[model samples]
Each structure stands twice: as structure tokens, then as C-alpha cells.
Target: MARRLFLHVGTPKSGTTFLQSVWWANRDALLEQGLLLPGRGVNHHYWASCVVRGGRQVDTIPAAGLAAWDELLAEVSAHPGDALISHELFSPAPDERAEAALRRLEAVADEVHVVLTARDLVRQIPAEWQQRTKHGRSQTYDAFLDMIQKDEQARFWRVQDVPGVLRRWGQGIPPERVHLVVLPPPGGPRTFLWDRLCELTGIDGTGMAERATRSNESLGLVEVETLRRLAGTLQDDGMPKSTQRLLKDFVAEQVLRTAEPEKIVVPARAYPWVVERAQQMVAELDGQGYDVLGDLAGLVPGSEPIPGRDAADVTDAEVADAAVAALARFVRHEELQRRRGRRRPPESSLRSRVRHGLARRWTALRARAGRS
Candidate 1:
């Protein structure tokens, strides 16, 4: 059995991707130091979480197979040292499912600790809207905010309600063992969050940040609006979820993120409501006995307004410009693939026959040269 198990449930859009990237990149080094990141790949934990939660599938992602949960548990049980399981998807699990997962986790380790990382709603709101776009949802930013505010069942609150998430996942675990790591406001050191994780887990994370290669890069306002439009069209055409996922991975992450358009930020009109909500969350978290690693005051947004145009305010001209740039990028990528011969040639084309003939002749020449 593992000695200690750290389950990092998440408040999404709070630097979870960067943390996971660093941990996965340094998994071998961490293993030598007695901290085990179980499973075969970076996304293994996410798939396992899906299985554990009754095969609940996230938008556009396929459901994990029934064996995923068992495989993850097997890895944890086999590890002799501390093990960590992390996924933002684990945050919003229903109460019974969350309890079931905790029960299984508790069976494999001497102690179970629930870790949550969170940032202010002022940032999370817009980020969550953009995330929905990536998942092929076409809901406008205004509609997303309205849903989250008015609907208790909004998916946003399920994951982003810091105090609520802790209460749900922290059940049955000792309050002191449940950890909340607050993400500091922007402009701090890049390694600050990693440092916090290391401090909590007692693992040496030196230089791990340099090794991390993945980031959940945010899209600019125009870029995201363009994606939202594309998503709506694809959904109308009944595009396969797998194909949508590919577009999100390639076009959104690779092409759209390179644009320099203005970023999405909370509208000035929403500041009062955002501030009030943040204060309420901080007040609730203050009373919770869970161990907090950073200042609770950091959860509250600042009085000064954040600068950036609302996503809804993005102009048609801006979206057109982004779309044209993305199209050009796709063309360039296709040309590069053809040049590198990564793309298959048409089977009936003269070019294909010539290429095959050249390949056979080259082989014959190599054979003769070797004999000589």
C-alpha cells in the first residue's frame, strides 16, 4: 500500500495544466525520491476519474473504459511510496461518486489528502467561457455568466465554486488533511504554484518548470469568438466529437493561440457581483478547518477594474481577420506536411507511381552497392 495519497481535485483554469505538466515531465525523478505519479501517461488520471465517476464523459471527450479505474488503483496499490492522482474533472463529481472514489483511494493508502488549487472568479469566469468554446459549445460569454449566476446546476459552479468543491471532496477526510492551495494573482514568478505543490508534498521540484512542455494556453478574444462560430457550425452539421477534439487540439491550440488579439476579461459591469461572490467564498473558506497554504484574502478580486473588451463586444471585422489568419495557417501546415511526405499521395496519380518507381530503383542500387 502507498504510504500517502494526494488527490488534487481542482478549481479549473487555475494553472492545473502547468502543474500537471511539470509533475509528469519529472515523474521519473519524483519516483526516485519516493513520490509516485501513478498511471502510464499524463491523461491517465483524467480517464481514470471518468471511470470512477460512473463513466461520466466530458464534452467532446470519449468516456473512459470500465477498466481504467481498476488499472489506476492497481498502480497506486503497487507503489510503495506516496502517490498522487490529479485531474480537474474530479472536482465536480456527485457526492456518492466522490465518496466512492475516496473510499477506494483510502483502501490503497495509509492516509488520503485532498488538494484544491483556486483563483479568483474575476479570471475564472472568462477562462471558463473560453474552455466551453474549446469543447464545441457555442454559448455566448454573456449567456455563460447568466447561467452560472442564476442556475445552481451550472457546470461552472460545479468546478469553480472553491468552497463547495472542497466540501464535496473533503467529506470523510480530516479537515486538516484537506489542503487548499491559493493561486496568487498574475505577475508573480512562474514557479510559484509549483513551489506551493512541492511544499505541500515534500518533493523536490527544482528545474521541473523548465522541463514542462504543455500549457492550457488561453485564446484571444477574436480567436475564441471565431472558434465559437466554428463550433456552432460544426455542431449544426453533426460533426463527430472526435473530429472536433482534433480541431481543438490542433487549430485552437496551435494556430489560434499564436494571434495577438486582445484577451477576454470580466466586464466592468460585473465587478460588483464578482466582488460580492468572492467575499462570500472567502468567508466560507475561512470557517472551513481545511489547511490553507496561501492567504485567503487572495481569493477576493481587487477593486480596480481589469482592462480588456468583453468577448461579446468583439467585432465582425476582428473575427474575419482571425479566421483569415487561421485559414492561412492551415494552408501553410498542409503544404509543409506535403513537402515532408507526411501526407499520403493520391493512389492513382502519376506522382505516386513515379515515387514508387524511384523507391524500387533506389533499393536496387543500394543492394548492388552493398554487394560491391
Candidate 2:
């Protein structure tokens, strides 16, 4: 029997992070069951990055990232049982890169299955906009949607265009080997997707649900608008991109993540168009006859109203309140650090203080002797 490789390329925000976290956390158990999940962390994202940027002179492509694929393959080849490589970034590969990636995988494994986790565009669109904001993008929701419509944001469509993503990744591979896992709609079973993924891979993640500590949380209208304003200020002041990343991370952990947030929704006016596009994609997928693990109807956008303040409805006052709250949190964190610092003064500083006091006492004694 030839070694089997299961690839879970993703449409982001479809619980990929949680899935990867579960797999990484339960690595020992998975290995005991004859499955290999090889990576320093949850997934080999760097390898996917390299594959997408193949031979391009991009500064983000590091030597280690480029070599990650080879290192992962070596580990897979050494292990006799099934191997799983997952990275959502891999789903965005253009035709050329996707073909090349598959060719490389075929050389080492006799059977390679392509997996794609999908959700309706109506839900995905707003989430994608929020994701960009977290990454330092300051575009308004209106502009974000417009940019996607115009295909101005290459990365957005690369990961989003479901049928296109499948076509590229599933090229030269049988439709039977191409698996589509449609995410359950809102209010559906939370564990449905995980259960389906496990069934497909023959990996048991029965007790892994409790291990999800990290997730990409969505932002409320006011919170996201406030962050956008901050990003704009940073840009206007010529803040370095690296500094922006630091600031974003600090706020994400210290302020935004601590607060309860509302989900962004597709405006009612835009609903029909979004649903129409999603249906078209679903039709395409059905026509292709790929093996779908979940209900195809799940791909249709739900009519339930998403409860939250619309992006357009966010008021300047609300944004100001959010900004002030963020500043207060930051100040409180700084004050706590200051208190901790005073309680634990460095040894060098303590020694310096002692030397200064002794010197002052000796000088006073000498002056008194001169006066006598």
C-alpha cells in the first residue's frame, strides 16, 4: 500500500485555525494512531507562502520558509502511515503554482487527496473585510466590497473564489479525490465541520474541542471603525509598517480581544447579489461532481438577519468611545507594568544607590572634621 497524503487547503475564516490548533495539540495521540502531523506549530504556513511566491523576488520569502516544504516531505517519507499537511494559504495558489505543488506531492505519495472547506460568500465577505482590518488595512467596508468586486485585491479572490480555487488545486487530480466540506450555516452544529474533517482523514479528534484557545475573533462595527481610524492615523504620520504590526498586535491582545464583539453582516440591499454569486459557485461545484462531504444546500446563504450595527451605521461618537476605551486599557496596562518594575528593581540600580549614599555620608564626615 502506497503512503497517503491529505491536503487541507482552505478558504480562510472557515474554522481552519481551530482545526489546525486541534491537530497540533493532539499530535501525540494522532501519531499513536499512525498519523503524522509534522510542523513546528499547527500548520506549515511558511511552505504554502513559498509555493505561492514561487521564484518571485519577494522580501517576505525567507530561506527557512522556502525550505519548509522539503523538510515536511522528508518527514512524511520517513513515516509509513498517512500524513496530513494543512495550510489555508495554499488554497490561493494560481494555476501555475498549484500545478507545480501537486506535481511535487505526487512524486512522493501514491495517493494525494485535496480538501477545501467552504462557506457561503455572504458570511465570508464581511469576515474577510474584518480580517484585513486586523492586518493593518484601513479600507472602509464599502471600499473593501468594491475592491473585491473589481478584483483589485488579488489575495482576496485567490483565497475566496471557491470554484476557481478548486479547479486550480484539483487540476490533473480526480474529482473523487477532491473533497469539499461546506461549513454549516449560522446556528448549525458547531462540531459538524470538525466531525466531517476527521471522518475524511481517518483521524480521531474526539476530545480535541476543548483545546481551542486562539481564534481570529470578529470585530464590532464601532471597534473595527475605530481601528481603521487608528490605521489611517498611523499612515498619515508615516508610521513604519513594522511598527503598525506591533501596534495592531498590542491592541488585539490587550483591548479588542478582551471585549465582546458583534459580527459584521452583509447589507440587505447587497444580499441578493451575494446569494446569486454563491448559487452560481454551488452549481459549478455540483456540475463538477466532486465528492462533497457535507450538505450542498449548506453552501446557500442563510436569510437570517445578522444582529449588529452595520458598518455604514457606525457613528463617530461610538468610534470615539471605542478609541477612548482602548486608550484607557493601554494606560492601565502601562501602569501595571510600572508597579511591577518598582517592586523588582535591578541589582545594578540597587548597588548604585548604596554607593551614592555611602559617598554622601563620607563627604559630610570630612566636612565636619575640616570645621573642627
Candidate 3:
């Protein structure tokens, strides 16, 4: 039992990956300062666990190899220092799940604080759909926008329904215990998402480290089209789960290490509409009166902030060029990573054998090819 169990419940796409990276990078330093971030297998097995719980058929991992969710909870309770669990999908849990999380946290924690970091959904949804595109989702930006705003069949909630998400999770947990870190601002120090997160998470400003686990998604329209086309081929070829996992795992930690996870996606450009809608939703949330942070900005009815338009209005020719350049960069980065990985790791005998086998004949073969 720790003095505080700070559950970083996410409202997603609000720099959750960067926050997790910071915490993991400084885990040893944080431990010295009485902060403990525990996961199932020494790593925050949170995503794997979440995939087990809510991921679609494609996300389905091996059930037999999957560790029970309750066992994961026990590990969280056993850890010393101020406990912290971060997984963005935990936003508004199902009634039973939320109740279970709260009960377990209450029994083990001296006190509990729900830390929610949110960006204006006006900006978040389109970026999210761009992400969905990166992950092989074929839904168009307009279609995804419709679902985020109005479709109930998908079980998507209004992004402005922040308090509702809390209400679901905070049933037994007290209202006072919840904290919110809002992105952007009503005024003063237009907060970049990272700085605000650092302020709230207690990570020292001077000690920033390289992020771990590169972003799971990033794509401009053409790259998205490429992936969408790939997904269609996947359906035809019956791509195996194991094959997808191997590629994604490497891509996450390696290929994306240098990739611009955020591209100027059209879906991102259309986000202002989502902002307007979210403003109405936030107004309703504000009336309910809960722990609040971050202004909904232009989304609020009377308080609509002028949209700071980025280069989204660029012509199709410009967009096509940008997309082409982005694809080149992504492919180049992946190629470099492949070369580096092959050159490195001779630790295992199998790797040594593979390395020697490549080294022994590859130069001669390359020389022959060059002559030809």
C-alpha cells in the first residue's frame, strides 16, 4: 500500500505515450523519489492487457498465454512508492469494470487520485481518426467524424463528456480525488501538451529523456490509402495475427523511432467542427460541476475561440507532394533500421551464425552484383 495510488486514467491522444515514456525512462530516479510505476511483467503490460479486454478480433492475442486481469491488479497493489497506472483506454470503463477498479484501488490505497489528461477534442478526434487510418482502419475522416459525434452503435461517447467518464469511474471514489490536466488554455502560456503533463506528473523539466515505444500510428492521406489498400489485401490473403504483431512491435520501437507520428491529416483539418460540437457537450459537463480543467475553447457556444488554421487548407497537389515526401521518409527510416538491426546483435549463437553467414558471402555477392 502506498501513500497515494495515482491512476492516470486517459482521455487518449493527449500525449499518453510520451508521459508513459517519461515515467518509464525515469523509473529508477522516480523510485528514489518514492514513485512506483508497476506493470504485469516488469513492463507496463497494460496495453497487452487492454488488448485482451477490449481489442477487436484483429487485436485478439493468444488467450491461453494471456495473464488474468485480476492478477495484474494484485501486482499493482503490491508495489511500494506512490502507485501509478496509465492506459488511455481506461477512460470510461464499463459499469462493472469501473466498479471493480475503484474497489480494488480503494482497498489497497491509502488515498486515490484519478489523473485525467485531456486535449480539446476539437483537435483530438481527427488526429485520432488519422491514427485509426495508420492502424489500417479504412473508415473515411468524414465517416469517422460522424461516428465520434452521433453514432451510438459504435458505443463512442461525446468527447466532451469528460465528467461522465469520471462519474462512471469515480462512483465509490470521491469527487475531490480526481484531477484534470487540460491541454491548450483559456489564456497565458498556451500550453504545449508535454509541458502541462510535466507540470502535473512531477517530472523535472531538466531531465527529459528519449521516449520509449514510438507512436502506434501516423499517416497522411496517401499513406493511409496505401494502408487501407493493404488491409483489403489482408482480408484476401488472410494475414496471420502473429505476422502483424511481429511487424507492429518492431515498427513501434524502431521504425517509428524517427517517424513524425503527427502529420497534417485532412481529418485533422476538419477538427474544428468537432470542436464546435464538443463545446456544446462541455457546456453540459460544466453544468454538472465536477473536477474540471482545460477550456473547450472554440467549442464553447459563446466562447468560440478563433480557429488557428494550420496548413490544412493546402491544395490537393500540395497534399499529394507532402504525402509522397512523407512516404519516402518513412520508408528510408525503416530501411536504416533494418540495416542497423542486422549489423548489431551477435549475442545469441543463432544471431552469430546468421551474422557470419551474411558476412562470409554477402560482400562477394554484392561485388559480383556490382560488376554485373
Higher-scoring candidate on TM-score, 2 or 3: 2
Q: TM per model?
A: 0.89, 0.85, 0.70
Ranking by lDDT: 1, 2, 3
Model 3 scores a TM of 0.70
The lDDT of model 3 is 0.54
User: On a 0 to 1 TM-score scale, where does candidate 2 land against the true structure?
Assistant: 0.85
Residues 151-180, candidate 3: write the lDDT tens digits: 643434622356566777677777667766
- How would the candidate models be sorted by TM-score, starting from the highest? 1, 2, 3
Candidate 2 lDDT over residue span 1-372, tens digit each? 228888888989888888887788788888888878866765355565555546552345556666677777777777788888888888867688788888877776778889999888888999888777866678999988777766734678788878888999998998999999998877889899889988988877888878866666676777777677666655554545454555456665566554667668887766777787778888887779798988887778876545555698876556656665665676686689788885634644322332332234335434554565
Best by lDDT: 1
What lDDT would candidate 2 get against the real structure?
Answer: 0.74
Q: Total clashing residue pairs per candidate? A: 0, 0, 2
lDDT of 2 at 73: 75
Task: State how far residue 307 of model 1 sits from its true place (Å).
Answer: 1.9
Query: Which has the better lDDT: candidate 1, or candidate 3?
Result: 1
Q: lDDT of all the models against the reference? A: 0.80, 0.74, 0.54
Stretches off by above 4 angstroms in model 2 are: 55-58, 152-154, 237-241, 303-308, 335-372
